[model samples]
Target: MRRLFCLIVLYLLIGGAPVVAADWSLAAYWAKNSPDRMIDILRGLNPEMRSSYLNAMALNYRFHQGRRIHWEVEAQLVRHHGMQDHWESNAVLVARWMDFPWDRWLDTRFAFGQGFSYAWEVPPLEPRSDPEDGESAQLLNYLLMELEFAPPAPDSQWSGMIRLHHRSGVFGTFSGVEGGSNFIGLGVRYRF
Candidate 1:
């Protein structure tokens, strides 16, 4: 009888298993004001590289339709006139929240989490008594909203999305209006 019960349990587990493949998505984004503030801070150091101010980024993510957790990363490459160049990158941990009512034909999600980042600011052509440029690793926070084409489901029946995110100042060191940098972007998600 014990052997029969063990066999039954194994059968149930095998029968309920579904084979699924991991999927990925890529998004192109353009935004203003973000990292703009950082540029604002950097400009004070060297006013020459003002026009070279450009902000563009790509977002990448992997998802498991069976689980609601996802990971994301963003990089901002900005050029300045001095030896001190800067790259801001963050690795984010995101969780999709329950759907809520929006307008017609759309669903909403709230994803909030934090990440670890590396930041480097180059020094001026000529060093001052105090060089404001340095490298640091810090903590970051993100609060985002995703608006998708279809209703929320375990497998997302059919959906595309626009994700908006804001990050906090590297851990608790710098203070800004609540929420980190702000991003509003669009993309699609397909699940098998």
Candidate 2:
């Protein structure tokens, strides 16, 4: 009986070890709800050129199944100068690298993802007035690095994130066709 009790206790001890799972959070934009600001600006300068910037934030749920891989779904919006607002959605698979912490309150991460977007534009009063840029659907590739403040309180649930993101495919098929935007953002996150 003594031996059996000892074995049971040993099993309990090993099985009850705390497992640290990769926490996930909802990410939001600091300034705008959509990614269309820069594209709108570009269009304003030259309506003949196809320019669009769409802004988005995603609710990321990460699972630590070996390495850190993130699955994200984002709802985004796009607006161009003299154009109607458009909505877009994306699903991204991201790879994440967690940098060494600085002190006790900061955590930095680098992530990359490739995604696609769809847009429906409101036809201009004079379709010929705004020449079609030719490109309809495009691919988006991005690199993002975020510095986050993770306070050591309430089980480290609250955080503030500062992120820099570079987005491509902002320009349509015509007129050189390649462009992107630089975004500096600040927002809050709640990790679960």
The prediction achieving the highest TM-score against the true structure is 2
The positional error of residue 49 in candidate 2, measured at the CA in angstroms, is 19
lDDT of 2 by residue, 51-86 (tens): 333345667765432233333433334332323345
Residue-pair clashes per prediction, in order, are 6, 6
TM-score on alpha carbons, each prediction: 0.42, 0.50
Q: Count backbone clashes in candidate 2.
A: 6
Which model scores highest in lDDT?
2
Give me the runs in candidate 2 sitting further than 4 Å from their true place: 1-23, 31-55, 65-84, 101-103, 120-139, 170-176
Q: In model 1, how many backbone clashes occur?
A: 6
